[model samples]
Target: MTTPLKLTEEYIFAHDLREASAKIYRASTKALLKHFRTTPIEEIDHRAVLAWRKKILENGLSKRSWNTYSNHLRTVWGYAIEHGLMTHTTINPFRKTSVVPPKRASKTINGEAIQRARNWLTSLVGQERCTQERTQITPAWFWLAVFEMFYYTGIRLNALLCLRYKDIDWDNKMILVRGETEKTHREFFLPIMEGLAPHLCRILGEAEKIGFSPDDQLFNVNRFSRHYHGKEMNIDQVESIYRKLTDKIGVRMTPHRFRHTLATDLMKQPERNIHLTKSLLNHSNIATTMNYIEVDYDHMRAVLHERSLAQGALSRVRRVDSSGTPPTSAITAPSAQIRLPSRKIADPKPTTLQPPQQQAAIEEVIIDRPSRSSGPSALRKALEFASAQLHSGSMESATDSPSDQIDQNLLLTLMASGLGVGTFRKRTQSERSMGSTSFSRASP
Candidate 1:
């Protein structure tokens, strides 16, 4: 017995969509009622829908608009069929249309713009203190609270305006967004963040001054007004207030921009926890959260700078002592100017002959030797020195020396030059067996 108009009312009520969403559905359905005012449910056909759609297209409506309006009608029709208000025998004419919505461009807010907005807010607070109407601090406190809450919570503007004093659990330190007010129509709670807590308290104190009940709206629009001061505010009025606030700072921004900026900042943390950012933004799909993160040049530059510094320090060749002993720390200083070992010198052989210059160089090398704790720096230097020796085609000195007296860097250098330790040992042993005089002689 229910008509299409009555069925539309029932469907909207059952869904419990937010006021803004309900308004859109109603507007879309209003177009349908105007076109088929007297048509019976069973008599409405595909031809009638096509004529209505053609008129909408001729009126210069966008594909997104066509899709939205068509979707609204289709949902209502489906609801009617499910409840037996209309027969399912007839095909849905709206679905047969070929309209497609265009892809939306990703939007992001500038960090510098946010900072400028904050500065403007701070200056406004200072100006309020200097005013003669210091007794009425509620208005100033209310706007401050609104501005901070929007920046910190990332909640939708309408959801925030709909918040009541009861929604805040001061004891538990959380704000609950009721399912009725939420865009998703699902209830969720946000933790009271550190920066946002003080502003909440300020507004709470202001509300208490008027004996605010649990059901009273958190933000009083009348208090915020400079001219048309009143008890309540509509969506248009709330947006107007926000526009004026941002205009003062000369930055064009909206409540949703704060959400994007916060999401991007959270994703840029050291951990880069995108899952945590998704939960914070209350996004049902992770892809939606990913869309909010824009490229940050500042963080990228820091990483590249650190990489360059590492390469510069690790790519240098370590210096060798002129006297053929371990190099003095003064001659082969670490690239970072840090007093860490830059190369591994061989264990010295027992003293035999001591030329004055060689003996002085050896003494200085021993006195300036780095501690065992400098292993990492020593390893880096060894790699660098070994690489240099490979390119220069250098060989280990064949002068008087024990097996253990060979430098680790020299061993690595020999290996890089295609001579393993085993091969070098075999060659040395063969020379000894043949009584070769070259075994103890210095290289020419």
Candidate 2:
């Protein structure tokens, strides 16, 4: 009732997953069969399996694919060993071998690239591409809408392609990607970008004229042909569409390229203090975001040094006597007109003096938050003011002391500005009047 290859095929469907994982097993099985020809299962040895793995590796299989194939082989051999089907099968060489990390596709889009792709898609919608065939896509804007969804929301290609009419909320401007309908199998709500929102409204409004149902697909492009019974687009085909779009737009790209570019752009700026690029990309790791967020360290350091020199911060401090005069050094001054500042004037108080014991005691106060700040450093001000009011006497610090001085200084400024207005002044005074410790809860 069962042959070795048939058993292997059944094993494949039972254990492996992720559309790509199964193909790796199938490829490994085919390679093994080709090598062994007529060898029985009990007679198959590690040597033959290793040769199969070697062939797969040599035949241009990616490390990830090889690693996956090796994992399957190991599983099969492990099953055989555990069940006494093959007594000599030991540890799998493939699983034991070091795995090369998979090369992840870029997942973000740059602004310029997004703009170019958007403009191109805009120009294509409703335009006839072929007079002989008497057929063209519904509208080029529809394609751009899909790309915009990915660029703004970081949805997987599969999820975007599977979007149905009901997937969107016309009233709320939210798109509901159902979990069962996603590649990661997790449903998430994506807020519509401002640019795409009206375009979507128009598309839905136009489609409504034809009496489209909520279950109807939003786009009718010939992108997904393989799994949709000739109607819907699947993940791979959706990716292919993006690829073709990028090519047409003259920008090398993939669906994921948008995600990478977006994440990088979100994080890669001198003034980018909010720096929620990872959260924007919906990444689980800071490291994964850093892959694209990597900065030119050499260039940055060089710029920093140049600025330090301009500010006189890079100059070595001259050793001097208590009277505040620089001692002569073997190194001569440069020919530039730059002159060193006066020698350091020591603080009136001794540097070594410690704060009084009473000053170190914990104090806490509570204050009501007014309008929360939305600047790059907004969180700092909101949290710092909240904490300072709780600790009127300066008890404990924030859980994450994010630039404490800046936060405290900003809070002071906000408090002063609030005092300038009569209505706000009462609210601020009442909030500050609450007993200390309102913000700082007792430590466990």
Candidate 3:
């Protein structure tokens, strides 16, 4: 029977993973080896796995870290089963383990903070150029270029570090991200954006001055660092630079934050093409890219304000004052018409108190014509027509025919009622003062 340690070793050797991946695998199983030691691979059960998980968590490892460890062990067990090192009946201890929810939320760096950092970096580089020998490029300049590249490209740090002069396609203006340097282990190309072009050119010139061939790393540690001379720049060294900068500037700066910031800024654009953003980020799945974006509440609020229904209604009301008629397509007949109930008008009493010669007239006004529809366009046309007739002095003309007067009254009534009861009352008073007849309320 093979021990868990021996099994992990065999698994790592069989997979032939890249150096970064192999390192991660080894680190993932460190706790597992400390607990299980020489125990038989088949003997570890779910209960034991649970106890180990508790121990790992107690040791201050996060749930996310525990999950990663569980996944690697599960993979190693599957590999053992596949290779006949474990019996077919053996179950994966981590198969039923529930993944712990991540504790920290994804975040993007503030643009203001980034701007401050950039200003500081620019000042630092300018000072370095003044103090340093003119023949050699300063480390400050290299870091500034790295910072700009992060801001513009959103490329992963490892992939950016792995880049070589040969990877740049000047003709196509693209950067080739090698598969070995990527987390997904799949190669893809990223466009060299306009903002990043000059920085790239400057860095390339510096690399050439330092005798770096096309095949050599684009950013070399040896060129600028005395301690790291003759050695390659690794992730830790890059992180140390950011750490020092963060201390000086009083902002938490990280390479991954640049990736997050780029995704969010692209998403906040008016176009907001998520697919295009995903392509730029080189994510195999759009869901992964989604995790990087921070919601822009201000942008969302602006969109909502622009497309609100209330604003649309107010705009339609304003259009009613315009001279242009509403489109004919919007003219639909309403199911109801305006009918004025019969009302008795009192005659003026004689000074002598004699009986009035004529009986009081009981007049009824009925507009049997189809009323305009409730739609905004139809209502707008009715109001526009009424307005034109009122402003053209047709209603005020004494020579106006009764039929024309009745038609104008009908339109006025429609407009008033469609607007509101208050408007209806105001219109009635205004029309009466203009010597125009008032519409009576219809009996139910």
Top-scoring candidate (lDDT): 3
The stretch of ten residues in a row with the least summed lDDT in candidate 1 is 435-444
> For each candidate, how many residue pairs have backbone atoms clashing (under 3 Å)?
0, 26, 0
- Candidate order by decreasing TM-score: 3, 1, 2
Error of 3 at 345 (Å): 24
Q: Candidate 1, clashing residue pairs?
A: none
Candidate number with greatest TM-score: 3
lDDT of 2 by residue, 262-373 (tens): 6565555666643376545544567766786535466588889898889766344433345545642222222111122232223333122122322222232224333343
Q: In angstroms, how far off is 444's CA in candidate 1?
A: 32
Please report how far candidate 3 places residue 24 from its true position, in Å: 2.3
| Predicted candidate 3 versus true structure: per-residue lDDT over 300-348, tens digit per residue | 8877877775555333321121435433222212222233322232322
**Candidate 2: Cα lDDT at 243:** 70
Native-to-model Cα distance after best TM-score fit, residue 31 in candidate 2, in Å: 3.8
Q: Please identify model 2 stretches exceeding 4 Å from their true place.
A: 1-24, 36-50, 59-64, 71-90, 98-110, 125-138, 222-230, 234-244, 269-313, 316-444
